[model samples]
Target: MGRGPETAQLSKYFYEGNDISDLPVNLSVVWNGNFIIDNPQNIQAHLYKCSALRESCGLCLKADPRFECGWCVSEKRCSLRQHCPSHESSWMHTSSGNSRCADPKIIKVG
Candidate 1:
């Protein structure tokens, strides 16, 4: 039997050389047998999402565009009163307040 139009299109994009080895065997049936390849950005995003540091600190060392933490340069944990050159602020101070540093439940990413 011949492939349907949609299937043919998908095959053209993902299996141009008739190589199915790149496709995941478990997910071959997810999108009507379409092979889903993760682009560079998608793979990076997934990595960031699964990262322990990213989850704990809400900061992706590889993906976040903004400066979320100031521990990149410091050799030790800084107190709220200490100045951080990377953050340009006191280590324990966030934009909101000093409670972020005081929170006992906060997980250390490093």
Candidate 2:
């Protein structure tokens, strides 16, 4: 990442776990000159695994071989209930949570 005020801020809170919510919202200055925000619906499929799993382990309350229900129904909740590896807090549960990969602009689709 380019070394600048935005990069510094992103690194400070993102890696250091500093008070991110307290930081200014519009203070970001994109150095890469690219709008890094991603649309939620456009996100990958496996990303929703948590919500899917949490909703229904997909086995009708039984250990169905077809469903093959594992921990936390699926990967999404498994990450959510257990913290997501892709982003901070698996879903930004904390005030200081800030994962550039998991932007809130995403729209959950059915």
CA lDDT of each candidate?
0.32, 0.32
Model 2 lDDT per residue over 76-107, tens place: 33233344344422343222223223223434
- Candidate 1, residues 1-110: lDDT per residue as tens digits? 89656543334223233222123322223345645654544332111111223322223223233333332224234222234445444343244444242223545677
**Cα lDDT of model 1 overall?**
0.32
Residue 57 CA error for candidate 2 (Å)? 1.8
Clashes of each: 0, 6
TM-score, every prediction: 0.19, 0.18
Cα misplacement distance, residue 9 of candidate 2 (Å): 3.5
**Model 1 quality (TM-score):** 0.19
Those runs of model 1 whose alpha carbons end farther than 4 Å from true positions after fitting are: 1-30, 37-42, 47-93, 103-110
